[model samples]
Target: MLRPMGREDMRAGDSDRKTVADQLKTALDEGRLDLSEYDDRLQRTYAAKTYADLDGLLTDLPGTVPVQRAQVQPHTPAAAPAPQTASPARQIAQWAGPYGAVIVVCVLIWAITSASAGHLTYFWPVWMLIPLVFGVCGQWFGKGGPHRR
Candidate 1:
């Protein structure tokens, strides 16, 4: 008769290896492991065959527990969150508020400079409209956030 598999002897899967790889990446990012050490641990992590093999790789890392076999749980459907949509006016106002302020400021500066010079300045403020144009287009055409596909 086949013996039952112990927890430590459970076969590791891609998800398991991925979890350990994430931890190793965190360790490296946090300066817990140097590049060479992290590289070695990462190699070993992917090659690990069982929970027992994966467990020891993270023993020295702080805030880590031994990898355990994942338990199966009953599947339950979660309630979907209600979709939020903004009114057309509200969407316009959102982008318009900042853009309007910037345009007003730029135009005011241009007006003052033209008044002092007795003619319209080169209208350098027109350059400021570039970003506002892009923002307006993004607001109207972008998917997601009041315009989700």
Candidate 2:
């Protein structure tokens, strides 16, 4: 049996239930609760038919998320055309465009040596031109490159 104080607490709990029922009814009347939600809540509150049942009616609803996920995924942007880049161009452009003096030197070495000896091997430095083109194109098409946040 509950103590006298426990009896008082039980009465208070009953009063709280009445308050909740009244609030739910008011929400239904005021059109705050949709017809479906109001009907569902009413079913719970009334069909419970006992203290334990009523207590179980409002289960795990407050402050609960709809779904659970171990980790949030980083938003990857949609795929683009084959040539589009995900990074800005100014960076590599600096090395390929403004700092392309090294390419010029290599070319000169290959040019001066090609006529005298075959060791100039201009093809070695030719590979640098690929990245250079990419950097320049990046500067052109990279206008809105890479997503912001």
Candidate 3:
């Protein structure tokens, strides 16, 4: 009898997400697939939680459109993370990372929790600058952010 598959062990049999993502990503980067379609497939593939689903997605990829994958040494540090700041929407998502959650939490604690506790009421107003600075830094230095990308 076959043993049940472990949750984490469940993955593309031979194909890996990174490889597949890289493949699709490379193709998209090379302009082989239509931009809109590339976005769709990529979004679908990543959204897929199972290998079976991923395989299904790729089955339709070759005929959908063709693009070349650039050879990148895995050992090399990834280039700042993103490329082509063509759309404002893409820019927004890209810059939303880099510990935004933690920063927001910290800001909340400083602005609301701490201020309420009377630990830092004097400087609570400075929290107003948090979002602005975060926005500027994220725009310029975030991994997937604008300009840096």
Candidate 4:
């Protein structure tokens, strides 16, 4: 038989802290908390060590629920972890894949135009290529890309 949860005596874990933090963020987003107050409460939420402590922080927030520690059953393995977002390199590759095709098409068009004109035109393709190169370099080096929230 399992014992009932007694909130006062229960210890909080990382997940519990994260849950309350998420709720606090929602409250902040909803304009319930100003910047300073939200920052203070967020700090306190992470510092909370017990379920009772977490409960106190959320008492004033609507729809907030007390954190409950997850229960484990014997003979069952834990569920697989959630899929991770693609890494920066993977994201860059994915973006580059189609963009590379576009560049190839642009080069083909430039080649056809030059061959028909019987002389090389000014490298107009460099206009397209310059920005693309800079953008990719920015994604590679600038703050780890804009996809990061």
List the candidates' TM-scores in order: 0.50, 0.30, 0.31, 0.42
lDDT of each model, Cα atoms only? 0.85, 0.60, 0.61, 0.82
**Which residue segments of model 1 deviate by more than 4 Å?**
28-39, 69-95, 116-149
Query: lDDT per residue, candidate 3, 1-149, as tens digits?
Result: 99998543465543455556777877777777788887887777767666655664555555332212335456877569665445544565555655466666667777886667877655554565578577766655766544453
Give me the runs in candidate 4 sitting further than 4 Å from their true place: 1-5, 67-149
- TM-score between candidate 2 and the true structure: 0.30
* Candidate rank order under lDDT: 1, 4, 3, 2
Task: Write model 1 residue lDDT over 15-134, tens digit each, in one string.
Answer: 989999999999999999999999999999999998888989999889777745336579998999997877655787877898899889989999999999999879998888888777
Task: Kindly list the per-residue Cα lDDT of model 4 for residues 1-149, writing each as its tens digit.
Answer: 98897877788899989988999999999998898999998999899988787777877888775545335457877799997867677878887878888888888999999999999987777777876788689877776665555
lDDT by residue (1-149, candidate 2, tens digit) is: 95564322332255556655666677767767778997888667755444545554334344222222225679999987696444465455555655498788878777887867855454677886887787666665665455432
* TM-score of candidate 3 versus the correct structure, residues matched by position: 0.31
Deviating ranges (above 4 Å) for candidate 3: 1-15, 60-149
lDDT of 2 at 34: 78
Ranking by TM-score: 1, 4, 3, 2
Worst 10 residues of 3 by lDDT: 63-72
Residue 11 of model 2 has an lDDT of 28
In terms of lDDT, the poorest run of 10 residues in model 4 is 64-73
